[model samples]
Target: MYSSIYGGIIRHKFPLYKPNVNLEQLFGKHILFLFSFLTHENLNRAIRGGALESTRDVTIANREHLSDYLKVRDEYLYELDVHLDRFLSSASKAKISSPFSRSALRSILIQLTAASKCKKGTLRYWPSAGPGDFLLSSTGCPTSAFYAVVIDQELSQCKEGVKVITSSIPMKPPLFATAKNVNYLPNVLSVMEAEEKGASSSIWVDEEGYIAEGPNVNVAFITQDKELVMPPFDNILHGCTAKRLLELASKLVDQGLLKGVATKKLTVEEAKAAAEMMYVGSTLPLLPIIVWDDQPIGNGRVGELTMLLSDLLWDDMVAGPDTQRIPVPYAE
Candidate 1:
């Protein structure tokens, strides 16, 4: 459970996401669920957190698959489900307004995949609608409603390398940094701010000079010893994509590809001298950061490990262990 700086508290689980806060300020009816599906190529990776609810659109492979990775997630989400409403308070946001539950997000992915009719681009489980702010309304729907749109698959073409810049942007403490919240102003601005500076994205930092995370993704790298290093999960978020990347990377240890995997406090200075660097997250799995503030990171190109790790994750999405791949029951 993470608390928003706006006196809001977010609870996570499939089909049941509730935010508790003062609706008196911002009408109780303007909110949406904060969840999205992560797909590889065109297949869904049924990775969830906090609450895992049942859906009629898709079927779990079996108890074994659930026990493999989702077992812990289920237990965690169940506890959140039972006490969802209990979080209601003045310090929390005041609504749950998504058109579909977390389960529906999964179900749609199944329905799409079962049709064998995917466009071969990419499919995302973003909310069909999202809440809007005071900045811009009047386009078509509620500034506070959720809408999902299909887009051309955006695979990074920066095979040579991509340039990244560090930002001095102060961050808003996420309501639940772990839970995916629909409110992402600070996140968006960081990126826009980065683009204005001719950089692709921004790396946010705290007042203490410690590296926090990327605008919308988690930061990770390799050390001289070949350790897959990520920052501590305290200030940053626990991303579903990042988790899967680590899981796949763990497998490479035995193959003598990676020395080990770990999470530690990473500073910018330490990062500049790393063996390799990449931004890990959903939608865009692992993107290599070749340059930070004009300094070349590792060999200044996408690392060999980065591609292998990406393939492992992509392969897992297409060919799952039955548990990882849910049979999306489509209506024939």
Candidate 2:
């Protein structure tokens, strides 16, 4: 339950409001679960609709309680000053180590739904690391860019497929690579190096030259015999799109269209020898890789299995069942 101000989050003090602190009351036969919303949308919603009903009137009208709350808030802000002071003097990078977040995208989607209804199409926040229960507060310099990909236009559509390079720097420790981290200084450099060498993307190779995954996506390869092989997830950031694509391929396995699915350490030679190679992530659900460095993989075009998986993924996203989506709860 600690808030990290290392990323310039605390300009003054943070409004670290205290929820119910009673042990017995909180842990009685009836358990009390709480969620905190620290976004502007949430605050506005509370005012427009209604929120914290039980404490709403009291918080606004009670002079003593209001004074005390304001005092505590100011005190918290002062503490932020102290922390910022020490942090600035410290040399090493500061990370806000907290609990591993669950359902982060889920919460964002809910807010996104609300945003859509309000016609407030933009929301901004600085990324932070910690276990979060919905309440988030952070920002960075307002930055925008004209992001464009310099795809190898010829190789992109080449049924023979695109070229990929092996990464010189291996992935970080298991946990660091397993979750999304904001530290992209090294990753950007690595991607640039790969692109400069004429590769569509890069495969992160371990010290022993075993392929872990990719810098931005999870890597997979299909054998000539029609087996889908993925790097072990224990050392890589799990990709949602990859998992869904694999799930959709289960029908293929049942119909004998595919052989099997496996997660194991794959060496560079093994991957290069694969019948087809692909990268899967949220953005590029399934992209093919035909050439690995100087060698050609299989027939050098996107594999049939890759195309099949891509079609299935696109279908699910574009026209999936209503049960798959959460409807926006727009105010009446």
Name the top TM-score candidate: 1
Displacement of the residue 163 alpha carbon in candidate 1, Å:
1.0
- Per-residue alpha-carbon lDDT of candidate 2 for residues 226-253, written as tens digits (9 for 90 to 100): 8988887776766555666677778778
Worst 10 residues of 2 by lDDT: 66-75
Q: Residues 1-332, candidate 1, lDDT per residue (tens digit)?
A: 11121122222223322366333333233332222333334234222212121211111111101000111111111111111222221013323334445465334334434332223233322221122222222222242222222222434423455678887667756444544443466778888888888888878776677777887689888888888888877766665567667777888898998999988887789878898888876555578888898888887878888778778766665663554444444335
List ranges where model 1 is wrong by over 4 Å.
1-105, 112-116, 119-158, 329-332
By how many angstroms RMSD does model 2 differ from the true structure? 17.0
List clashing residue pairs in candidate 2. Answer: 13-77, 99-131, 126-138, 159-301, 160-300, 160-301
* Model 1 RMSD in angstroms: 13.5
